[model samples]
Target: MARQDTIDVRELSVHYHGHLALKNINFSVDKGQLIGVIGPNGAGKSTLIKAILGLERSKGEVSLFGSSVKAFRKQISYVPQRNMIDWDFPVRVKDAVLMGRYAHIPWYRLRSSKKDRRKAEEALDKVGMIEFADRQIGELSGGQQQRVFIARALAQDADVFFLDEPFVGIDIKSEEIIVRLLHQLRDSGKTIFVVHHDLSKVEKYFDHLILLNQELIGAGAVKEIYTPEFLKKAYQGSAAVLDDKDGMVVVSQ
Candidate 1:
């Protein structure tokens, strides 16, 4: 297969208070591809994203768009887990979405032009939350709030989007809507990497998979890498697979 180079992380490692989270992780994502990072709890999935964003204390090199992460920050956008934010904060939906444009705005004198407002509104409409444009963020449901954050990321107009646990508390309908929106974004030649929860849907939803367990386990096309054997190894470190004359069988961890 031809190598598709987009975001390259070479020998990357992350540490927090002397505890190693990610170890010698390396992978390259292709442009316009939807990649899903899967792992059991505490397996360093979120830490990997943080390291790439230059937010975590880390080692080794992380290059985005063939340049240093800091230099390429403007081209990337992130949607953090909802629990990471203070939900009670006083901010309207539109204003929250507008925050994504701050990086592109002129410094010192803070102001939003008509173009900014239009873009924010359009993003909200794209996520089916236009009617809730002026609603206070705390007034929305968990799924609606997630969509608002997605709208904000959309407003960024960044080439690469990183979303963390976007499906945790969302309903099936909301999940489908978000997935469709992500596909639309990917079709427009953008890279979207999401930290997903549903294990069964990985093959159906993502083009690439980044399986983690404090270290890289597998990373490739879902159909090729998301096999039952891989899942067994991921969930049960030393577990054995069973087969019989009755037919091939998989033993649970």
Candidate 2:
């Protein structure tokens, strides 16, 4: 079977309070690939995702599953940046994960169905957080909190996943687990876009790269877009020097 493009963006642009954030961006993403949304800070990495997901007001054409994004809401799952989450909210770990299933419920139903509950439980177990399900969300470590949210996405069985900075504020152990889970999702033919920092891990983690800085810098395989020239363009003001022997990006202000 021919592979399908899960996401298609054309002439995409985003502005915040009259400030241009992304300008006339364009790209296509295929399913089953781990694509990194890479750029310097405030580079519209998150905005690009929001624009495509229809979470932000923008001018552009974005299609999911070869159709309007609005038609496929149930198949999409988003794990926003940590700062966006209300950790202070008194929600239990399991309950938080169950929230992802809300979209699947019909408008008439007031509660999740039995199957929804079962899937949520399975997702928690998959992330190794089933035992902690009874605990409060705020009490868990950064990594644990991340895992719980991932479990939320998993329960949804979403086809397209958007994760914003999944690795930030987490210990090494959690990072490793998240990386493995992402790869597993890719292998299972799920498309994922991760807004990532730490250019050092770009080569190791992502199958494809979307290098962005207000506009599209490059979008393709990591080897095609991870060049010094591309990195320099994306990190223009900063000094991004690439070592000749090994592919490591050294960035300094």
Candidate 3:
């Protein structure tokens, strides 16, 4: 039997003012795959994600789990880049996470139910942040904050996860922990898409890749799409692909 597609994008395009950011992009991700979306700055990697999520004005057909994006919006979880969040928001860690449950609650309901709180606690425990649930989000370190956001997504219990630059500025320990958790999610049959910048860890971190440079360069398994030629094309011949002792490729631009 064939695997079911978790995300499908066809003829996706985005425009910022009069400038075209992404043009005619298309890709599909199957269930249980960890997908990396890589490109240089201004390559529209983030734009593509926003377009798929219907967070930006775009022309395309984006479907999640065989349904339209609007129809299944609550089933998807998105973790934006850290810079996009205001650290001084003055919200508690647990409260920040419980925000994920708002979609499940009716608008007439003014508070989260006990079941929602239980789910939030479980998510916090999974990220090892349960002890700090009462602390202010602004008081945590960068890595801890990122983990809290991850827990927020976890609380949503989403089938598809989209994270933008998740590892950027975090410590090695936190990065490792996040990667491990992501793998666990994939193993549990969730589809994960990350906007990643580091190419050195591509082979080790992701099973599939979407190489983008305002257009689709390549999209497939790491062994097939992560070639030196594709890297050069995606980075406009500025990327240096080096082979490590372990036979994995390390890319520098």
Candidate 4:
């Protein structure tokens, strides 16, 4: 028996105005897998995500579930970094989440259908934001705002979810809740790819990892790739590998 690939990225490279960001990257993700991409700042983690979403110009091929980006659009949902969206946009929580359904609705129609509205409310409730439906987007806290965005993505009912820095500024409780929701999504046969910043929690959380540094360094199971040696290379980018405590290696700065 042969297993099919969920995400196939080959020879992927990205350049920003002639500045090379990612170089000759390649990776594959299977269905129902939760992948965590980690690297220091400017290590091209987000660049890979953007390229896959067709948000940036790049040289490579990325196919989701054996389909092109155009065909895979409907099955993929994205939760961008909080900084990318405006908080004071005058949009209510309900209306903002309903935006996910606009792709399915006809442009000629001026309002959301009864079914779409129901789905939107259900999505908000899933993220525990149902009561905040009437509140303005700007009135919520950071974790609440993140949850609303996740709810919007959930309303889309996509098979693949991409999250960028979902745990940037939040308390431990909120982070745990978000992680739990992500696990629930995975159990439902969804694939989640998150750009994570916390290196210490990588082993405690993700099942797989993609470690990068302007190029692919190592990617595989977290237990295998989270070794001290890999961490040293990922964090310091030094060729020398020094052994650290806990039998892990660290390259001194």
- TM-score: which candidate is best? 2
Please say which candidate is ahead in TM-score: 3 or 4: 3
Per residue, candidate 3 scores C-alpha lDDT tens digits across 1-253 of 1124667888889989998999899888788999999988889988988998999999988878788878888889999999999989989999999998888999999888999999999999998899999999989989999999999999999998999999999888778889999999999999999999988888889999999999899999989988877888888766676656766455566
Count clashes in each candidate, considering only residues at least 3 apart in sequence or on different chains: 0, 0, 0, 1
Residue-level lDDT tens digits of model 2 in 1-253: 1124667889999989999999999888888999999998888999999998999999989887687889888999999888899998999999999998988889899878899999999999988899999999999999999999999999889999999999999988888888999999999999999999788788889999999989999999999998888888889877667668755656745
Cα-based lDDT at residue 226, candidate 4: 82
- For 47-149, candidate 4 gives per-residue lDDT tens digits of 9999999998999988888888888898889999999999999899999999988878898998889999999999998888899999999898888999999
Can you tell me which runs of candidate 4 are displaced by over 4 Å?
1-4, 237-253
Descending-TM-score candidate ranking:
2, 3, 4, 1
Deviation in angstroms for 49 in model 3?
A: 0.5
- CA lDDT, candidate 3, residue 222: 89
Which regions of candidate 2 are displaced past 4 Å? 1-4
The models' CA-based lDDT, in order, is: 0.85, 0.90, 0.89, 0.86
Model 3 regions lying over 4 Å from their true place: 1-4, 243-251
Model 2: worst 10 consecutive residues (lDDT sum) = 1-10
- Residue pairs in clash, model 3: none
With a 3 Å backbone cut-off (N, CA, C), the pairs that clash in candidate 4 are 228-249
How far in Å is the alpha carbon of 189 misplaced in model 3? 0.7
